[model samples]
Target: MTVANGSEPKDNGGVTPPGDVTPSETPDNRPSMSDLAAGYAGKAGLQRNSAGHVDMLKSAGGVQGIAESILPGLVFLVVFTFSRDLGPSLIAALAAAAIFTVVRLVQRRPLTQAVAGVVGVGISAWLANTTGKAEDFYVLGFFTNIAYIAALVVSIAIKWPVAGLLFGFVRNEGLDWRKDPERLRAYKLGTWIVVAVLALRLVVQVPLYFMGEAGLTALATTRLLMGAPLYILGLWVAWLVTKPAAQPSKPSSSAD
Candidate 1:
């Protein structure tokens, strides 16, 4: 047997030489799951910026996203108030959503928010018109809140807060944030905030829904009051909670 560098033999009978070995050639050299997990951390960090508000808006589709979200309901309310006609009110709301979608497409912005807005308005209008009850227009929102509450609770139960996953994913922090106790706690807190917002929506709107026609206007008001503004507030708090912890300074070296 011949040795290289006065160490182990380069080849012994059937054994392959060290120089021919590569990471992919051996099972021990295979990349671990942790390595894959860490690889995305840098990318997540790059996407997340210092301005949490802007990032939140970006996730929703920016200032235009806000407009798209609110305008449909606003238009429906205003038109319904003046016309006192369900068909016309629904039409106006749909038109407003369509306009937002068009504007988003023309401006080359993301269509996810715009499309969602249009669909939500369409469903709400369909429910109200089909059921011959104006209050049904807000029914979709009630179900949506319930769904959100369930989802948030489920995510927390699984030890993965939706707020943390979403914010970390956007910030390029990936699942690495979960490894930090402080960051994980922040994410849990943030997830609860979202749960609270959804719960509040259900609490306020459900009663109004059962009130019949008299509650229609009140339902609309409550929807507006607790809609985007409350969600944004929760998002902001989550961002604050997830902020990176300050690193401890290294101990100063003693002079010899």
Candidate 2:
């Protein structure tokens, strides 16, 4: 047997030379899960098999993505169930939803963003009045209006990193609370107006709760004080709902 350098091999039990084999490459050489985990480990400066938690943010949104994930529907469920007596003001919710839908169409936003923004705000507003505190009602509405957007952005950032950037666009640009300056302020005033109306409704509800006409029905309907299970649940969720995401640690350059 004879071996040659950098030459094609001849038949008859001959050995091929060095550089005789050509490597085939294709675009479909996708990375394996181990490769991806390894890549993230390298990027994050993690040690092999270290006792490190899986970074969901790197896996998902980082922060804002987690917020957007659960907020919209939670706000919706809270408002729709508690504020069922809004009656005509229900149109406010509907109109906001329709107009926001059109805004999405004009801006060519994701269908879900538009839907969530409008409907979520409306429902959140309705639930804002459900709080027993009259003075804080509008203030709560104004703030909660923005919460779901924040939440949606957070959730998307976590569950789907790619889609999360879009969430930021809608929150920052669509809401325009910061740059526009007046948008959040306008929401404040609008909240006040709606709250005033709700306040009036509460006054009227007083008679119903006090057994003016219907005794048992009115008693069941009124939730002015915060001792009830539903009210307590609302306050609990509200408290737990808006906490910030845990911050990831940065790599230290110096030795310990």
Winning candidate number (TM-score): 1
Candidate 2 differs from the real structure by a C-alpha RMSD in angstroms, to one decimal, of: 22.0
TM-score of decoy 1: 0.76
Across 1-256, the per-residue lDDT of candidate 1 in tens digits comes to 1223222223221222223333344366553332233323222221234543325555444567677878888888888888889999999999999998888789897676678888999999999999988888889988888887998899888878877656664444646777787888888888898898889889888999999878878888888878767777777777777667777999999999
Clashes of 1: 5
How big is the RMSD of model 1? 12.2
Model 2 CA deviation exceeding 4 Å by range: 1-85, 118-256
Where does candidate 1 stray beyond 4 Å?
A: 1-47, 50-54, 169-173, 180-182
For model 2, the run of ten residues with the poorest summed lDDT: 162-171
lDDT of 2 by residue, 43-140 (tens): 33211112222233322322333334333333333454566443433444455456656755786755664565555555545654565322221233
Whole-model lDDT, model 1: 0.70
